[model samples]
Target: MGLHGEELTFGVEEEFFLVDASGQLVPRGPELVFGTEERGGELQQELIRSQVETATDVCRTAEEVLGHLTRMRADLAASAAERGLRLLPSGTPLLPKSSHEITQKERYREMADRFGAIARSSATCGCHVHVEVADRETAVRVSNHTRAWLPVLLALTANSPFSGGAVTGYRSWRHVLWSRWPSAGPPPMFVSLEHYENSVAAMLRSGAMMDRAMLYWDVRLSDNQPTLEFRICDVAATPEEATLAAVLIRGLVNVALRDVADARTPVIVPDEVLRANLWRAARDGLNGSCLHPESGELVPVWAVLDELMAGLRDALRTTGDLEFAEGMLARLRSTGGGGDRQLAAYRTRNRVTDVVDELCV
Candidate 1:
């Protein structure tokens, strides 16, 4: 049976760091905050005890996403505050200490044991958006179509500019740090669902990754749900930013599915080119040029976004998210994105600690 457009529900998953009152990373705050029964399940500990993750329920509209995200952020912040810690939504800690403790879980323990220092040193956080699809076939197709655009999304949501108590000089240093993994970056094009499955199986057998969960492509088919998860964005610093990112991602999926229904061929940019484009976005964000996914020529970031929005216009209209998406995009363009805002704050105070303080609020 052909897939229907109305099945395009979406959800947002955001990872955040816990900081002390001085705006420094706290290695045990997540455990202290989320280990209690009263804290409930909406928040969970991450690989590192300094980090926590929260997910919103599946939402169909941008308004619902904004509402859920706002409520969850407030709840998580309150929980953290009660423990004398603050919730920080940036992609990386501005003043992280040399080491971070791992959460007390078997899976996290195994990851630390298997990966050694790499696992321990990874204190980065991110925002993931899952867009629902009808089946694995559609998920794979949507993932393929969405690959090129992931970097553009990353540029728009770049929030990590500092690491290890110093400026990293990259807009989304989280992406740079994440690229150290063997399975990160854009996924390769696949001819069919079987091809995608075989590729993941090969990665598993090769021992490069522990399991399917480690298949950390920029976008991928969700192993535990009927959705295509966009894992490229930094955890946005504000609720509105996160909501806008989710809305655009859902619209992108809708447009890709429509293309699939029409039997249009998917754009197949070379993996090398795709990786270069991702690097450019990570290093410079929207302040610089990006390689056009179709033409492979360097273009201003705004132009690329314009083309992308044009492609998704119908999907946005059908989903009733066009107005919200457009307004957010305009604001981002005018005021700059989260990373730019962080830098502006740092410049004003001449201190990374002050930047962290801004993020805490």
Candidate 2:
């Protein structure tokens, strides 16, 4: 916890697609970018050779997150440019080939072997936010409290409206593709930390997951760090948007922590309902209604967002992120989300190339 009794410390991890001069997916981009001996550990290869990931260090404020993400994105863009490639921060590849493009790593190979088709089809990119927690138990509590709101965050970050050079008719086709994983979606509420561990252990024994790291829940306790990870968002189109997401996630976690401290019971929506809400968010982004987590009633997406902001008002202020969050929210509503922006770009020239060009720039 920071000085205000809030765990505002957080970090962001973003995955990007590497494209060629014409904005087509480049199969060897990861090898060219991250294969060198001088490459830093912060940049890594994802499941696909054309995909690269960069993670920011632990950030104490939204400004720090923005700085780290800006530097990392600039470095990655420059590196890709040097290799005659362009780095595109998007959820799905605009022109991926039909075949799988796996990175040549042992773990990645093992994943391809185990998951088969699902692994092969995973050229998707996402943004993950990790917020520090006191311990495993507190992390579990925060995860439970935070699960209901994950869909709202997902809608805000929807950037993958097209896939394989055609409109998917969904704002976040990446979420649809990612939901194919057996371990994906909202996790069940656990009675305790031991219960959570046992549940994961059961999944491992069932051969449903390769390891603890394969637990792809929308929100989960980090396997390698003392933080609760939020995996519900697509990679934003810009560093500023990513930083906005990190700020909102930190605020949400802080609000959850305060609720736990006050002995407030976590909302326990049915798994089916939660999944439906997630689907709604993925399909519509902020253009349609969503299931209100607290009221169990369908409401406009903007209404749900306003409710979320209202709930986190104090926490956002306490963490010194209120003004920035509000400003970003207003801008998002005004200009529309990343998906809308992509659609607008496509609508302008009726060319997917233009969308890719816009995203890459």
Candidate 3:
């Protein structure tokens, strides 16, 4: 196996939209990124001025990830408050956004010039988990093991129930919107390292991606790091929820690393089954059913969670994250996933702004 079992350290990247006191989208945000960076944070500008991203340092434990996430979020919140702005931690635009200016980087400007409408409307935020791997080929291999679980993860963090003052019906309208990008969505099963590289080359030729660095796949080999980055989740509603996703993913990586060492075959489900499952998860969130990643039978999402935790039991205990992971799941159960929580708030006063107000904290 390429990756050492103990070397699968992880980190989290979260993107957020800038907003105002009344839960309206704030159009400009480079100052917010700078402000947070000045405060000793790792915040950076996203594609648009209305969005910012925070990337955490590589961490060895879920607890460490939680601390980093909490600190970075608080730093950004402080920065936003200083400018009388707020942050909205969801997938879709929470309100009718004002005009957005692209971030002033040449690459970003080029992206805007080429992608045009998609670039303009693609301020959708997400949570990305990066788990260290031995090499690019190993990252490609582990993805075959990890892609099956993406729908469940997406369901657990489906935070975009409404968009632009209208109920979107789907829990993750952001997922629906993001699907419009030519290069975005689940990664294809690759036969070998050559296969992966050639496929990426083909995407560039097709203009589906601007560069190797612009892979918008659910899981991809990091171009700049020795990691497998999972991008199948909405930006979680809270730090706790994000931590749950991160810990579970790290545990899964641990298991996959072992499986790779033993030469176990990676699970490969049909593409249609994978797409349908994602659709169901984005539609139903945790309130309904999704197809089992392997068996292809519809079952309660909680039952899949049980199966997942059972598979992850030993790995989590090894990391001393079993109890913390369970507690976070319990919190998800009590408060429901982000979509359920947002729907509950929207139901309370029949106002989408209330949902934004609640998330602002």
Candidate 4:
């Protein structure tokens, strides 16, 4: 929230893997992270040298996000071309990659030293959306309202279907691998801002996470920014899809704020149930069954997605994002998703490079 009561600003942080000509993840992130001074957005190294991430400047419309995301990706892709590597905006490595080096940072070094195997093998990527909030209390309330729809978001953007040159039997295997972290998953519904703070203190005391930066929940209040950060979705296949996801996230927050202003309490499920649907989203994407957010009964993923769209329709319309969002959704429905496309390509010729070739474009 800003001076305007209807202010809607957001940002997207997307992680990507570097790969060679053969589609294997490679330890070449530095070439992009250090050479991205001219990129449209800020580029940073991830925990592993095989992964790099880009953070967009604050954006108020889908066009800004598209401009920044397109330019940043093109710049990175060009840099990779110069080095004979490819910029792979994937949620997980399609082929098995050798052990990668961690970035030379004190925090990364400490993580590798303390977490051991989990840190050694963690190279998954994701797209995190941060929607502006007026304060921490509002962010908490918005997070509570947004919790039930997390899995639908994941199902929509899932793009990690192959791993180690074989079908992994899961759309976003990155979600499965990322869940190996002790603190990563759906967060508990907090009763108040105080409750949220106390819970973080408890987690710190238990040593579940090294710091506030490691909250890792699907949605949480940002420690350094006035926004509610969503860590639910995988990096989408294209810039248009990413823009769709970002605006949808903003719509959810806008609707959540309306509910909060009206003194409406959100209907929340038990933590276990939320985690159940999350796992279902990871395993099936949109091709299998998922639980209804309210009924808790298994249903087709499209039904859940329709329910989500209905909930956000008013907010999206009010924000002038309805047409752009609908266009992207139609395109995705027509062409299918990145994960499905990869599986379809693999079905032809049984070649993983064929899948990589499609992504490289």
Q: List lDDT for all candidates, in order.
A: 0.84, 0.86, 0.86, 0.85
For residues 1-361, write the lDDT of model 4, one tens digit per residue.
3324666889999898888888888887976778766645688889999888889999888889989999888888888888898887778887865547998889999988878889888888899998999589878888888899888888888899977778999988889999999889988998889999999988888888899898889999898888899999888778888888899899988888888878788879899988888889888886667888889899988787777888888788877888998887777777777788778888899988888888873
Error of 1 at 295 (Å): 1.1
Prediction 3 global C-alpha lDDT: 0.86
Off by over 4 Å in 1: 32-41, 96-99
Q: In candidate 1, what are the lDDT values of residues 178-259, reduced to their tens digit?
A: 8888888899998899999999999989887898999899888998988888999999999999998898888888878878
| Shift in Å, residue 162, candidate 2 | 0.5
- For candidate 1, what's the RMSD? 2.0
Give the runs in model 2 whose Cα sits over 4 Å from its true position: 1-7, 35-41, 96-99
In TM-score terms, candidate 1 sits at 0.96
User: Per-residue lDDT for 1-361 in model 3, tens only?
Assistant: 1244364688999999898888877766787776565433367788878888988888888888899989888888887898898888988876675546788899999999999899988878899998888577777778888889989988988999888888889999889888888888899998888999999999999998999878889999888877889999999989989989998998888888788778999889777778889999999998679999878899999999989999999889988889999998887888789988988999999988899888984
Clashing residue pairs, candidate 1? Answer: none
lDDT of 1 at 16: 87
Candidate 3 weakest lDDT stretch, 10 residues: 1-10
Identify the superior model by lDDT, candidate 2 or candidate 4. Answer: 2
Clash tally, candidates in order: 0, 0, 0, 0
